[model samples]
Target: MSALFPALLTASNKQALRFDGRALTYAELAATAGSLAERIEGAGRVAVWATPTLETAVGVVAALLAGVPAVPLNPRTGERELAHILKDSTPTAILAAPTDQLPPALAELTRIEVVVAGAADPTPERTLPQTDPESPALIVYTSGTTGPPKGAVLPRRAIATTLDALADVWGWTADDVLVHALPLFHVHGLILGILGPLRRGGTVRHLGKFSVDGVTRELSSGATMLFGVPTMYHRIAESLDTDRELTKALAGARLLVSGSAALPVHDHRRITAATGRAVIERYGMTETLMNTSVRVDGDPRPGTVGVPLPGVELRLADDSDGIGEIQVRGPNLFSGYLNRPDATAAAFTEDGWFRTGDMASLDADGYVRIVGRKATDLIKSGGYKIGAGEIENALLDHPGVREAAVTGEPDADLGERVVAWVVPTDRQSPPSEEELANHVAAQLAPHKRPRTVHYLDTLPRNDMGKIMKRALKSA
Candidate 1:
């Protein structure tokens, strides 16, 4: 198989990456990562202290060059979760920037400082290690909503196939430059945002921390694309009415993509109305890197995740009322959960389709509208199945509603009752429960209206901006 980043193997001087104002050309990155690779070439696996920094990016690239699997450890992870990941992956060494204070759990591992300043080799002559397509390249851990986080072993082929498919669908080219402020631990930020640009020999500028001003500056200065999650897009939508520079910057960009969680229809309308740039959405999970995305040349359907990517098979299992659990099989899928053969076997069907616990309905044009998760988003009340996502969107349409999340509670009459958790735009003058319920009932069906409403200052969310519904249920 060829090198994952072919441009790195060359001596081109084009800028490949920029983080926190520090820029690196392809020639510099190749030499730096090559030098680092030689230090850990024989390791079985390495752990990268995944921070939004240049060193983290160089470290992961170095591990790939050495044909060693890299495990990205989230910096904000809880102590127990971090301990579990280290125990599970059993990495022989850990890589971090010199300035990072080592956590007690990672203190015992062999530490390697990734320094990018003086490692550049203008002319490099070392032969990069050849790795098989099926070899593991990354070990990304899931959010572990059910139990301890499970490591999803992604292979070189999965990464290559996904990026290539996205290039074809997005019309991505080497001339493009991407701007984003997404976290580096998740696949959305690391694989799609960072690695995707590298594979195309393009440039990526990371925002260190996401801010509307930072996004405006980069997009206004010739960035071709923007990748973000729903939370970030929500913030952008809120600022578009007040920030003229942001509106102009987004309008000038060639593409805007949202993922990790579904972007609300309300936010989609706000952004598109202000900037004339409809934000396209994609659907995938830890097990499957990417399955479906809205095409660049096709309709930017506001609420749907377009169709399946090239060379992927998708199906709906246990259909009812035109909605069912999504199942997929593709080269973009991870090899399996690391060291958990029984769990891995259970994740797949007898025919080899990976069972994604998300539920969605397919449109006539093969567009996928994700309702919610099969476990948390599906609600059954009065013998009618309802998706929390649609109701939440409807709630957001109200002028007084700022944020909303829906869940089901036990009901003596209706097997389960729809419950709403809301954050009002004006805390002192929040919308009444009856008024909000009526608003939702008018938009959707009467049966889908919330039976109980609870007010909150904010909804719980994870690093990727996904609403933590389980936390709401527990609360």
Candidate 2:
């Protein structure tokens, strides 16, 4: 109904974005985006060169200003993945900075170079075009775990609702400065990390690349908030005991949030012990921007992602043990997959709840603890629906274990048996299979213990520090 980022028109600040040592104020950004939006105002969906750069932000803003839904193309995307996205979205224009060279996959599209701010706003009276809130804003693709990744059409309403809900939960305000170094292609970086702050009329300092020094510098200097994936936080937790600057910087921050993947309880405890600040975890997916999060004022539960957001209604479908596939209904839900009507229809239930394909359980207080994904993380063994995440966490609790992933394998007798893939802290003095099995058996049920154990030097992880469980099974 109204403009998504009203701050761009009202705010006069000159520090809206601090990207790669370059800063653009709200006035400069609005001018740059408005100029670009005028050129492609009537185009179909556009494809973005989603690099972690100031120009990338400008490109996305321009698309939004023009009411053109953009498909963000990851710079590191493989040829196959790139091909699928290009064929599916079929954008009319490709947006990129002068420095970015187009890949072979984008050879078929019409390319347009993204220009940085030119001079200043000549006419501030011409505001962003008011578009329908239900119109598609983005066509974000999934991780392609099942098949060729489907384009989830995110509407303007979803973005506005999710950001407003987060603002209320985290006590976020224009005075707060957010700092992060996450990739720009995904929701975590593009929406929450960048747009979230801009919507609140706040400043964002994005390290072109993440470094402990950058985290220390930004958080210690003026940044009030930090958003990172589990991998970055793990490194921070590991070094806190040795790095005084980092510990102090983290301690002084107003808030620290982790998402994209679950943060291990061990890392959480270490960070809290070192800095006396708990890292808040939130749960969501490509289809749903955000559903649940540990509120800034709520108990800093080590392992659980706290209650559902304001408009989100969640239920565990047919699960009496407080655990099942998480089904949700909210304004934050995506419209549907771009052109795949059948697939999108199947994503929702008969009653219209979107089946989140994620297995989770709610505590007595309504905090959500995600067990794992429905496909890879749910291990049905001997009539028990075992969550691989619990066993993985228990294994992580062992001092000798470094990394662990659990999966189910075909077993004639039990239908499916639990298998453990472990990376020991010391290979030469690795923990015996018997000992590790007993360790899990003691923590959980003996039946849940690994029937077989495979040791590797390292676990296969994606860019976000998420264990690629599917890769492990094939490995």
Candidate 3:
């Protein structure tokens, strides 16, 4: 319990990780990590900006093994964002490649030392340290939708607890080979994609970046499992017609996981039809690494996100409406938001449950269904509440529609009106506003039907595949 990496290293030995045509075993990974940890300053923060590669993974764990906090930065982040994070965290050094791709401001930070890993370690004087469960390990930044981005601090114990819960719920073993496609900056990719499999003596194949071609190639190369966002799945499904071998390769995958955003029912059916594999959708956020997941061996429901994982507790704040905000409490819960005491205090309830800000309900059988985000996606019109997810799901049923996002538009007549922004597969064959309204009218209640429908070639999305509802409201 004290040192999670050491336990993982002991448990996993001789496992192979396939990277760029080379296979590195767990023993090699451990040795490399131990060597790199000796070079970094002890008990300080290090900013990491690199693509998902074997070297990047080793650097992250090496920093943690030295009792240093690791902060993962998105490779596509701008200079402004990088400046803000550096100013806030004030890391002792930056563990990045010696490339001109870094922001100009980063180059000016002469006080901070920079170490280029992946090559021979010229400075071999540094040494690794033992880590306690309560020690802060990693800091993951959240998408600043409401305001400026804030880093969420996660402890070693929380990460270990999450991995243990995932392994128990999914029955993960050393035999499983996880194909990772998402960006490593996010927690989902870090824990589930990298650490989860590595902890179990299993192999993780890093695809570098998420591309239909890359994933298709990896799957053909004997990747057994895949973890991606819903949009990634949709893109692969859309590209299937161009590459029949991609479809066949995906069909050969043992498991497919969808998360970060809700999977459209239409895309779900398309994936199943093309690959004969039910895409298993899971629920998690930056504050909590993983809470619940759809059963892999049980009935794979299209809309529902399934039950809570082991050692996790989920409850509704107020059950008057049968749907209330989701509250969770578990060992995997994050420590708190970094440097924001008031915000952190407001995020949790008096009873120590973390308020998730997402509306959900548990069925009689204990399956959890995420209704919508409480703050943005729920629309109140004429004293009736409407879930945007329901209307979005119905719109996806139309063959002509490739993607759709539903939001509430300000209306003088009703308090708010249901409005849909749709991206059509064929621009010329886009469904008419009347046809789309009628389509929802047949499936949903009269009030839930979209009164105004607009067609767009593409919808603005965040890095995590969640639709930018704020952009839709302003539009």
Query: What are the per-model C-alpha RMSD values against the true structure?
Result: 1.1, 1.4, 3.1
- Return the number of clashes found in candidate 1: 0
Cα deviation of 158, candidate 3, in Å: 1.4
| Cα displacement (Å) at residue 290, model 1 | 0.7
The candidate maximizing lDDT is 1
Of 1 and 2, the candidate ranking higher by lDDT: 1
The segments of candidate 3 whose C-alpha lies over 4 angstroms from its true place after superposition are: 6-16, 41-43, 108-127, 241-243
Overall lDDT per candidate, in order of appearance? 0.92, 0.89, 0.78
Give me the runs in candidate 2 sitting further than 4 Å from their true place: none
Candidate 2 versus the native: TM-score? 0.97
Model 2 residue pairs with clashes? none
Each prediction's number of clashing residue pairs: 0, 0, 2
User: Which 10 successive residues of model 3 have the least lDDT summed?
Assistant: 110-119
Ranking by TM-score: 1, 2, 3
- Candidate 1, 227-343: lDDT as tens digits: 999999999999998899999999999999999998988899999999989999998887899999999999988878999999999999988888899999989999999999998
Candidate 1 off by > 4 Å: none
